[model samples]
Target: MRVAAFLCEALTRGTTHAEPLAVEGNRLDFVDTLRQLQPDLVINLCESLAADSRGEILIPGLLDLLGLPYTGSSALSLGLALHKPKAKELLRARGISTPAFAVVQRPEDVKAVDLPYPLIVKPAHEDASMGVDFDSVVHTPAELARAAIAVLSTFHQPALVEQFIQGREIYVPLLGNAPRRALPLTEIHFGQAFENRPNIVSYKAKWETESPECRDSTSALCRLEDTALEERLIQTAVGAFSALDCQDYGRVDLRVSAEGVPYVIDINPNCDLHPGAGFAKAAAAAGIDYPALANRLVEIALERTHGNPSHRTKGPGTARRVDPPNRNVLAGRGPVRHRAGGPRAHAE
Candidate 1:
């Protein structure tokens, strides 16, 4: 099988995100390579091109145009997931317990917010914890205005001000299509250094391994004694995943309140898949190793395209010939705020 592991340059070597896709495959660092050496399947790890996350859907959009099957969510799903506010709106509409949020399209728009304070302000259309820090959690209107203004000026997008849910942070990873199941859940335990800081996962905690924020925030497989509560959390996660129309695999991040209610914080359809990431670790807990997980993604894509995954499991899978075409005009980010009675964005 000629499988191409599509990834960005920073994820090429010696990185946590690079190790999961070490399965037998060709390493494609550029879209041109994808055009020249067409493969049977693609394990898309390239979150973005040209260092802009807005370009995350460009490659997948191209593959879709060329009728090439790839792993994870589609271009439309990626674009929808990239916008935090819009995603939350859909979740709320589906009766999913998400924090109340207000979108600040401009700095002055902050005054229109009616949600309770101690809101977490972040860039409207970004992932990987971009533009999120301790200061993002504001308790006063003045602080909210300042944070929203900073996010607007920095990310050139609206600021999503969501109610800050303080509780146990949990992440649930889901896989497959017809019968999607939740992997072992992970709980983020903030250490002593986090005593004075908000418990939210910031960009520094995610991208900077050496930083105090990253070092102090730890993740462990959750252990629950209440079976009913555990069941509730699983149902919530699955409901949110289904609501988003996430395909192949995705992760749902939530915070368990003091009353044991789970609130959906974020739904990442194209989340990190490195061997050390929470998703892979959860898969490992279920006895599916990284190599097998990677291969399973390929098989899922093949199954969705051909209706049978059994044949693809054998080595050297047959490739459907596809002619290269002109690049797609990438789909940009959707509207920052959902208009009243306007169409909603769903999983593709």
Candidate 2:
């Protein structure tokens, strides 16, 4: 089947994270060319548009209106995943463990946090460690207020002040939808440089490739000596993924405490799919190469939308899965601007 890879041009500029030349390559007119070619399916690699993550769902939404099939989650799922607080509320309601979090829209709102100290503050709707740093984890109310203010003033979004989970960071990548299977657990290894820093994936550690933090913060397939604990982590991750209503392939990030309890931190449906990314790395550990993984994503989308491809191969993408909007409180609307202590609200 003819396939088109959709990517954002914003990543190439103002960030050393991903090589624009390599990611964009010769597909400069990728979107336009995609419209011209009208491929059988789309492999969405575009995390955002013009550096704004809110635009991540726009392309997929367009594809839906165009009556096209695409890999990964739907437009609604992407929106829900981008906003951290909304996703957390969904997980907590599912009986899955997520750190208690309060969204601070103003600097003074930080004082309203009823959760414990040593909270990690982050931009409410960003991914890939954006607006996160070592200083984001605060030990006192003053530091939390400063961090939340910084996030509010800089990113111009509400700050998500969550209880900092001091434990091992585990990443779980799930494939398929109905009978989704979790890949081998991957752990972020904070190297020697992080001995003095908090064990969290900060912005510098994730984006600044040449920085020591980036060099030291790494991911490796975790080896679980206890099979029961391993199964529990996988089950928790799967539960979190299902709670968010993610489709196709997605990754769930969790933090395991000293007591061996796992807390879901983030659910990324349109996570980085680079061959070197955590999702692909976990897939590789499970014997699924990049090509196979890509094909499998397409296969899953096809199976869900068109039923068995063998029987419905003749159609012009007539059979499509109509994803009904989730009616839950955390349903798709926009970035939820979480209140300090009251009802959860969102911002664009």
User: Of the candidates shown, which would achieve the greatest lDDT relative to the real structure?
Assistant: 1
Scanning candidate 2 in windows of ten residues, the lowest lDDT window is 339-348
lDDT of 1: 0.71
In the range 1-348, model 1's lDDT, one tens digit per residue, is: 011222322223331222222111122344454456455556666566555677677767877876667778988788878877777878888999998999999878988999987799999888767788899999999999999999999889999989999899888888888778889988888887688789877876765667687778878888989888788888999888887778999988889989999999888996666565678778889999877776577557667777765354333444533323421211111112111221111110
Q: How big is the positional error of residue 105 in model 2, measured in Å on the Cα after superposition?
A: 0.8
The local distance difference test score of each candidate is: 0.71, 0.70
> What's the alpha carbon RMSD for model 1?
9.2
Q: lDDT tens digits, residues 195-307, model 2?
A: 87798877667766666777787778898898988988989988988877789888888899999999998888866665656777788889998766765776687787677
| Candidate 2 C-alpha RMSD relative to the actual structure | 10.2
TM-score of every model versus the real structure: 0.81, 0.80
Show where candidate 2 strays beyond 4 Å. 1-36, 309-348
